[model samples]
Target: MPRQSAGILLYRKTNNELEVLLVHPGGPFFVKKDLGSWTIPKGEYDDSEEALAAAQREFEEEIGSPVTGTFLPLGTIRQKGGKVIQAWAVEGDLDADAIVSNTFELAWPPKSGKVETYPEVDKAVWFSVAEAKTRINEKQAELIDRLVALVV
Candidate 1:
């Protein structure tokens, strides 16, 4: 079976404009990537676990704070690699500049013997729906459309 991941897309309204929270990945591979590199705070899950619970867990893991709100299901999308992502839209807010993400160790320079530690998410930002569509993974952009249909 293909890998399955779950995540929560946090959104809030300010100045009568809707904004969604998106996270930029850390590590050298993504260091220079900007557009089409951001994504919902998400992680993988298996058959034994529930998708919603995993989404909540991943959100807290990546954002360093637990999230609770009325979760509006945005359904699923398949990425270019065939990994499936299940996402939900929740009305909420978070301090983009103050986020603290969990860390992971990766072997740097490919076959080099050096290892480096990096945060799972280097930064988080809230963007208007129009802007988020450009920042988030292209395949996952559909989640934004679903959110607009459900709440706008």
Candidate 2:
């Protein structure tokens, strides 16, 4: 079976414009990449776990803060690689600069026999719906569109 993930889409309004939080993946492979590399803070989950609970857990794990609000289901989408992501939109605000992501170890430089630690998410930023469309992964852009229609 394909992998399944769950996540929360944090959204807030500023100056009458709707903005959503997007996170950049950490580590070397994503360092030089920008546009189309940002994504909602998410992580894989197994079938035994409740999707909403898993989404909240992943959000806190990836963003270093807890999220609590009425979640509007943004539904699910399958990425090009076939991983399915289920997401929810919540009206909330967080300081992007204050994010503290959890770390993961990876064998760096391919077979160098050394492990390096990197954050699951290096940074997060708030982007307008339009800007988010350009910054987020193509498959996940549907989440933004769903959010805009519901909130804007």
Give the number of colliding residue pairs in candidate 2.
0
Q: Which segments of candidate 2 are over 4 A away from where they belong? A: none
lDDT of 2: 0.96
Q: lDDT tens string, model 1, 81-116?
A: 999999999999878999999999999988998999
Model 2 per-residue lDDT tens digits across residues 3-103: 99999999999999999999999998999999999999899999899999999999999999999999999999999999999999999999999999999
Off by over 4 Å in 1: none
TM-score computed on alpha carbons, candidate 1: 0.98
Model 2, residue 132: distance off in Å is: 0.6
Could you tell me which 10 consecutive residues in candidate 2 have the lowest summed lDDT? Answer: 143-152
Q: Give the TM-score of candidate 2.
A: 0.98
